[model samples]
Target: MIISLSPRATLLETIPFPAVTVCNMNGAKKSVAEDIDQNQSNDSDSLFEKHMLRKLCRDNELMSGSKVNASWSKMQNFMVKVSQPCHTMLVACLWRSEEMPCHAMFNPEITDEGMCCSFNKVKRNFIYRNPRQLHGLNYTFPYPSIDWTPESGYPPDAPANANPWRVFGPGKGLGLTIVLDAELFDYYCSSTASVGFKVLLHSPVETPRVSEFAYFITPGDEARVEITPKISTTTPDLVNIPESKRRCVFTSERNLRFYRTYTQRNCELECQSNFTLQECKCVPFYLPKDSSTRICGTADDECVENVKDITEKRLPEDYKNRTGWEKPRNINCSCLPSCVQIFYTKQMSTGKLEDMFNVQKSFLGGKNLSYYKQNMAVVHFFFVENYFTSFEKGEIFGFTDFLSSTGGLLGLFLGFSFMSAAEIAYFVTIKVLFSKLRKNQRKENITQTRIFKSLPFAE
Candidate 1:
């Protein structure tokens, strides 16, 4: 009799098996089948080799299919959990608003002081004797002539240039330009107080960027400048957590009116200045000073403390209502943090240098001996991350992503596509709705027939 066998059955039957034998060595019996199984098990130790063996064995009972399938399943899971990587670039700068104190000295010949130049001699004495008193004062060399127009032209915006730098003995050394007076440079070198400057950062990309400048200095002689950068990030949703949570993301003005890139520190300083002006009708010497307002001196320490307490809301309830004391509007000064994280650190060093140069010839035709000494401070900025820009790897998956992955797997292994998904939806929704409608129609027809049959007269 002839018999037909299925493909799986044929495959199983075709799988080869080694012959078994019994042998004795040193009074110990060993089976040849056991030796063959041991060699096969050793060959199957590697996952790839095991998988190949299982495929080769087909439906053979000698291979465990579950183990090979599980290995591939684990690999697929690992690939699905991987994250994507990206990179970015950035640019930034530093700036300040408060004006530096400077003085211009006249040539002895022009002032007609002979051996003793009034402008140079007196100003030098005043600077060395009482530097604090010279904070907002402007001194012209030999005074300005009737026809003399201010060499430093007005800045385009006045509010930004409200407290313009005092350029001493200058030719167009005003506004943001450095003072050209040698004497003023000497004074800056000798001054014990640290100076402050504004820093601004600019970038072409749409990503948000911010920076902050911090330094250690004497507490009472602290520099007035405050550096704060805006917060920005590509992953806003992740960094900007709700009030109940937090994330790692952190979140400039022009010449006079700094560009909007000004940092939070800038806003706070400006707000404090405004508050001081409103309370004491003056600002501290370190802050911007105008003709309408005098600089706050040591004598105004009490008033300054009062204003600080009120503005910062540190005063008691009774003192809160003190006349002319109003809380500063911090809301208007609100600043946001950048989504991207940025940290900037600075190191500074100081040194002294000596040089000799010929001073301008005086009317006396004799050159006076002048000593040039300079004390300089250098600052270096570096990124803590050791890179100008950085990248973060993240994974964002949702229910839609899961469904898409499932559909992709189906298409890869079972030939399923969008059309197949649409057909399934149609069967579950449209077909089911139609079937329900037909069932209701049949029940209504049955009731109608029964009602008609019961109406004997109308039959």
Candidate 2:
């Protein structure tokens, strides 16, 4: 039997395999005409070679570069667990007319900003995804599958789920009104140097960093954020162009190994993780890294801090002049921005909660309204209007336009068009032959007239 390999195989792959295929020669050999099939699993040497080959392929991951993928896993194995529970952070929650329990409303996620309670950011498969699988599942955030994207909004026939799902505009009853109980007494060191909750609206695909971007909602004051959903997308026509040439990657074009959905923030985070790994030899606990990628411990704290400072600090060289004689961030990251992006821009309005306390008391089950007014912050999240301006990136001169225009002529033949080619053909062949035929006909007529005139004397 002849075994053929693919022509596209590299020079290294052209080598003959020393390992032999294991095939049964008993019953199959009895029939001389029958073909024998070999099982690859039975070949111990072949199996070992394949396994080693796979490991060798992944060996390059040890090196550092931009656009490198960072693994993102659950924070269950980390030493830090349950620093601050969701119930403690969010005392009360209200979305539209429905009231959600503090524990069930938000899903817990670990970030650089410490304990985070994510709202409407969990996987649709599970209501509350328990970090430890042995503990079993909990239906804390009992909602339908979120089928919304930057390219496509919520389905027209989607289930009536919650505030974000419903798409309600600016109104007290229609939006998400949450009363935050900022337990400032237990505060040790405030990162923002203020006593209040940091309110942030970001893509559900992204990990929210409090230090990166946030809007502070001070305690005892009601802050209403008039959300204006911003969307930026590249035209579908640009999909044919190479990602490297376009300088932007579509969701399907560049997929992150850790993230299910690709976003600009996700790309940057992944890039940062790889850069950190390159400089410090280990990545931060918060960054998305696989088990193989070493987690930065106490020993690597200094290195990690230095890397963070380099990335976070605003430097003219970072943005203004990329090319320099010697740069600290030489190979920072070759990450291209995502073709599509969605951001929630908020316009906040603040006022003392003492004035809006009487009506909110009933929502709190008639508890100590006077006490909550002093310690609580009611935040409302709603759309400012039904319509908002969104940006779209498209090709100015498309392929079809080029083919129809003078550009196509230059591509087909140097400095010549279809009209010019047609004119040349007419003059060189058709025009020359037609003129010769007319001249020959005229000569034949003249010859016939002269012959007739000479023969008239005989008639």
Candidate 3:
């Protein structure tokens, strides 16, 4: 008997082996049929051992692929839940005790905290994939910009540059007082299952991520934050080095596609968006991406997470199990941090609020403190000082400063300025001319006197 293995061997539990023929051991009356059958069976077992293990691996891959496809399937379930709108999240916002329009001061933004309002954010050109499809979208919010940049200073048209900082709206005192509502009823679906808000203080150039870092402000407690500027300026010499060697991008090198500035956070956001789009065919709304790109919804959560896991290289299981040496490929962004990084250090103090009787009547809003206490949190965002000393060497020591400093040093060490040296030259020239005139006059007088005395004059 002879066995021949077919090409398609994965579906069957057993595969036929290659043809095998038994030869006689003693060359006299050897067994033909039963002996050949036994040899073929042995060969089939060997083939199963060699290829069955690989077939099992292929099965696992197919199963994993099915999961990925299922996650990518169309599901209409993920309608954006705008349970917390701007008016809902922000109960009241005050600039130095005067209640200002919250909608005017803040623009409705999307963060991991879900439907957040951002204040003092730089204006960016953004578009939603499905703007009209989103219900409860705030159409009245205004887009704002400081008209500021690292390369160029603040707007020059504004009168008086005394402050040298952006702390004007609330004057020299506390900046803005904000009351947040952490609706406790919505906690069932949240991962944290807590009553609070995640307060993140970051630059206007960056898109804040709740996954990366945040400070939690619990409900019913007032948090007072005194912000001090933490700034580091880069010298102009660093610009000469290549970006690969220096590992930091400068203001002049704003190479980012979506943002006007190139920050490390922004670069990472774009990198993540592209990578996620490559893996999952979509990107999250918070990421800065092209308008044409598809936005991810609730159904794509698994694929997004898998892509994140792949980028993070959190595949130690395969290594530990020694399971065929398969590992996730990490996403390489090759993004470097910005050379000029502006940060703020905040000193915060918290205190519990008094109950309904002691609480102010304005905050009560005809509703008792029982309703307010379960949902409200107040934050005092203030500047620690009126002015900050930022030693931006890029703007300092220009051609004019260099000339002025050189001349000042010459006057200081050598005791002479350009004007003083010019004055000395003028005086010396005038004195020399006067002395020559006097010599000529004396020579003429002497010659006349000698001639008069030697000749027939009356002496």
Best by lDDT: 2
Question: Compared with the true structure, what per-residue lDDT tens digits does model 1 show for residues 345-393?
Answer: 2333333322243322221112123222221111222111111223331
**Clash totals, every prediction:** 39, 0, 0
lDDT of 2 by residue, 188-273 (tens): 33445466666667765466665567667787787877776656667776787777666777767665656656677776777678
**Model 2, poorest ten-residue lDDT window?**
16-25
| Candidate 3 residue runs with Cα over 4 Å from true position | 1-80, 126-146, 159-165, 169-172, 297-302, 310-330, 356-358, 389-459
**Relative to the true structure, how large is the alpha-carbon lDDT of every model?**
0.31, 0.54, 0.53
Error of 2 at 327 (Å): 8.0
Distance from true location, Cα of 243 in model 3, Å: 2.5
lDDT of 3 at 88: 60
Q: Where does candidate 1 have its weakest 10-residue lDDT segment?
A: 83-92
Residue 164 in model 1: shift from native, Å?
Answer: 18
Alpha-carbon TM-score of each model against the true structure = 0.33, 0.63, 0.59
Q: Which ranges in model 1 have alpha carbons more than 4 Å from their true place?
A: 1-261, 275-282, 288-303, 306-332, 337-344, 347-428, 457-459
Per-residue lDDT for 330-394 in model 3, tens only? 45676776776666667789988668348665555456688777667777887655455453323
Q: Which residue pairs clash within candidate 3?
A: none
Backbone clashes in candidate 1 total 39
